[model samples]
Target: MNTINVVIIDDEFIVSETLKSYIEEYTPNLNILSVINKPNDAKEIISKLKPDLIFLDIQMPILNGFELLKSFEEINFDIIFTTAYNNYAIEAFKVNAFDYLLKPINVNELQNTIHRYYLKKKNNPLFQYGQVKSLLEKINTPNKTERITVPEIGGLTILQTSEIICLKSDYGYTDIYCKNGSKITSSKALKHFCSLLKNHPDFYEIGKSGIINLNYISKYYNEGTIILENNIKVSVPRRSRKAFLETLQIQ
Candidate 1:
């Protein structure tokens, strides 16, 4: 059996140590190169020692494991990510990660994950640049651009959900009002934007004509009316009013 060079990166020392011990006691032909707690510290380790595998914990202080991956130019190693139950992060992992082990790592599950690692090691085609790009886009999407890509006559316009104060219907098309004083007319109807933003936590409908991004909103008036940042006002009808307020409170 070929020795699999591995490094473990986790903020919790005990957690990393426990995993190290488990791998040593239960898994064979795996050489532990370095056990690191900090992402910055892991940089030197990674550059100096090109390990075959990395047992990465997604959430770490100063820098989470995912952030560390961005620093590396060439990711030629397989990764088994460890993360807590984060809705977005979990969704991102669905795109990548050989296998993700949830917190309070189960020895049996760990063993199973290691077994899968061996199977993948035979053809470890993980973490290509495009794959990595898509993966991070999924993870960082909600809090980042979180934009709706609208195809236009000239090219395209990306309306960042965070910057959108509200949306209004213009016949069949939708007019997106931004905090930056730019107005956009998307070919899609207001209902389409509503559906796209339905799962998105930042937007809520006001009246029949409009949807407003929650982060930009300051307060809500009755019947879908809302006072947004910079005192820009917008409103929706009574039908969506109740649902919008409830969604606001939940958000």
Candidate 2:
């Protein structure tokens, strides 16, 4: 029966405000933590607000919801992605995000999301925290990643996690290189993807700039440089010495 703290973020001023009003009117047990229009600002507020639920927009000018998710090193809150597009819906479910709601929002759906959020948390706070930890580990690994669901940019194509050969950070965004020798730019960070790659033994984070799957390594030499299956050599960073050796030994 305690009021749930919540925040909403959207690029559209009207949509954000409208959602805020609806929550206030329909959900009396909800406490308005804050509402923001920008993803970067939302990141800062999220650290301070620590809301139980975040209603996030998938598309925005500065940073999308996926990108904003990367900014939080630790995510202990549930998120409901609010978007007009349903293309990423299945992927959203794959990542185990709390729920998804389409734009021109439906009050009933919103209420259902909130109701589930409350019941889940109220009955099993520990379980929710465990899910958060699992999600973090799943996102931080370098290889052996599960399928990633990004908003379908072109047609209905969904990118599989196994297709990724490597991940690298560029201008703050992550680039996913596939086995077919194609690359896609993602709004999320390499760190975020790394967290999601935990269960896969084939991937390893050798350094700060890159994460590579060992299955793609063509050769490993004494000098800490590895030749990938694609014939790209990656120099292991000095700090990762102990872990790199340990991982190698295990394999």
Top of the candidates by TM-score: 1
Report the C-alpha lDDT of model 1 over 1-251, residue by residue, as the tens digit: 78999999986666788789988988888899999977779978977898888898765545657678888787777778875535566667775654788766778988898887777666644533346666766676332325455534444465556778888888988888888888888776787666556656667666667777788878776755678877878866666667776777787
TM-score of each: 0.54, 0.51
List CA RMSD, all candidates: 16.1, 9.5
Tens digit of lDDT per residue, candidate 2, span 133-208?
4443554422322455442233212466667677777777777778888777766667765655654677788677
After TM-score superposition, what is the CA distance of residue 70 in candidate 2 from its true location, in Å? 0.8
The lowest-lDDT stretch of 10 consecutive residues in candidate 1 is 141-150
Instruction: Point to the candidate with the largest lDDT.
Output: 1
Off by over 4 Å in 2: 94-97, 126-251
**Clashes, model 1:** 3
Count clashing residue pairs per candidate.
3, 13
